[model samples]
Target: MTDRFAAFRALHHGDRPLLLPNAWDHASAAALAARGHPAIGTTSLGVAAAAGLPDGEAATRAETLHLARRLRGLPALLTVDVEAGFSDEPAEVAALAAELAGLGVVGINIEDGRPDGSLAPPALTAAAVAAVKDTTPEIFVNARTDAWWLGVADPLGQALERARLYRAAGADGIFAPGVSDSDTIGVLVAGLDAPLNVLHRPGGPTVAELGRLGVARISTGSLLFRAALGAALATADALRAADPAPGAAYPEPPSYVEVQRLSAPPGAG
Candidate 1:
């Protein structure tokens, strides 16, 4: 646990910002691991949507746990986006953290955003972070503040305030997902005591630019999952349109055998 935690922490301090891609399921995680990504994070949106539940409302705790348990044997470090810790009670959240830690999960992302579109009280969120650390000291608790994401006025100020509280509560990193501007990101990078994580927007700063802004980590959040869904719809549309003559050039996908191999046990031939 200590070694895995240390490796995840080290990724934040590398020359370039750690490109932490978020995965939805076993196959997605295994594919990323096979591509040599050092770590993989579970997307809360993907988990919730895949289960036909809503995200950020604490509605997918069971699904999140099931995915975490299944992902434990993969060859990469795993961090889970357990939306709002799935409960407001610190003890319950801590218990969840302990469970994930036992499954070899090295990190977790807990947000302060509520489904009602309000930020959770900073003190309450801080208590949750403290509880998780107390329960499993080795798990990297990434305290997330969605001030910018909620479109709150003075989002930077709100985020900075939460950052201080969560960091003092023993968070290893701070994630502000909707902060996209260079100036705000640089300020967060300088102001936060722990590593600052920003979401990677498509048209916004590239990974290299974010690295220059001193971001320690860049999260894809649910972009990959959403993109996959979009691609699937587009492919279906193309297939239907090409039914008469099949003239369109279809995109090649992995063979069934290759996808089947992804589900095999790590040591199985």
Candidate 2:
């Protein structure tokens, strides 16, 4: 609840949407910060996959905390995706939020989607949002309702209803992913009192288009991680096939020395 928190909160109100790139590990986070992203988010899928766990099952609390500890030293604001807060209990979720806030985290994404393909009850989600705000008022809480993501009937109606409850319970922003249409995004931006965040799709709409539709924040959730994985597999396949120009499809990676420098401790060589 200081400059970092305020700065992160302020990003949502910028003239353009705050383009937040989600990272899986320290290297990705550090690399994005070095590339001039003022804020970075943790992709729940990426984190769980990296730890050999499943995402949205509340299974990666320890892994998330460990990564947060490692990322505390990065030169950027941090927002963690605590998938459903790793627990349905309000106090438990709030405690996790407080812990992340203490570790220099500025924000968190708490989604209502469950592992079993159901959305949490609006009351449960609201209680968690309220508890987190009570525990750490300064941390930005981007409450996520996965109505569209889970493909529920009346997705927009369900999302708006749940978002209202979360906002009333003290959520700072409302994120409804999987709704990529411009008209729908505009309705969300116009309907909600809090900032509306959307997920970035490669061919759906550009960042500028989202901004034009009044999106406050745009997140690349798991896109970078999946891309990196695909690139690695493609490179391996090319080499196995003895094909020429195997590296042409991917961007050039950082030099070995550059990576070593990035991984070094503050005073270490």
Candidate 3:
């Protein structure tokens, strides 16, 4: 546990911003791991939508746990996205964190966004972070503040306050999603004691730019999942229009035999 925790900690450095690619399930995670990504994060939207549940509504707790358990067996480090811990109660959120730790999860992203586009109280979120650290001491608690995403009051002030509270409560990192400005990101990184995690914005700053701005981690955060959804729609439309040149081409997928081998009985050839 110490080694795994150390590995996760080492990934967040001043020189390199950890580009964490978010995955939806086993296949996506395994494929990313196969491609040599050091770590993988599960997207809450992906998990909830895949299970026919709405994201940020505390409706996919079981599905998120199950996905985390499946992802923990893979080669890369696994970080589960527990949407606001799936509950308002701090102890319940801690229990969820403990369950994730028991499943060998290395990190967790707990957001402060409500179902109605509001932010959770900072005190409640602080208590949740404290409880998780007390219960699962080794698991990295990335306290996320969606001030910008939810359009909360005074984005910077709100995020900084929540981040301070969370850090005091033993959060390992502070994630301010939907913040892409270099100056703001630099300020946040300079002000916070814990590592700063920013969402990867397309056409925004590059990883090098983020690293220069002192961002420790950059997450895709459902962008890939959403892009996949869009690609699927485009592919279907192109095929219907009998124009194969309108969409991106994909490589030949694995056969049944190879997929079956992935789940072959132990010691069977």
Worst 10 residues of 2 by lDDT: 260-269
Arranged by lDDT with the best first, the candidates are: 2, 1, 3
Which candidate wins on lDDT?
2
What TM-score, over all chains together, does every model reach? 0.96, 0.98, 0.93
Ranking by TM-score: 2, 1, 3
lDDT of each: 0.92, 0.93, 0.87
Q: Write the per-residue lDDT of candidate 3 for residues 72-122, one digit (tens) a residue.
A: 767788888998898888899999999988888899998888998888888
Tens-place lDDT digits, model 2, residues 92-125: 9999999999999999999999888999999999
Clashing pairs in 3: none
Compose the digit string of candidate 1's lDDT tens values, residues 1-269.
58999999999999999999999989989989989999999999999898899988888999999999999999999999998899989999999999999999999999999999999999999999999999999999999999999999899999999999999999999999988989889899989889989999999999999999999999999999998888788777777777653335345666899889999999999
Candidate 2 residue spans exceeding 4 A from truth: 267-269
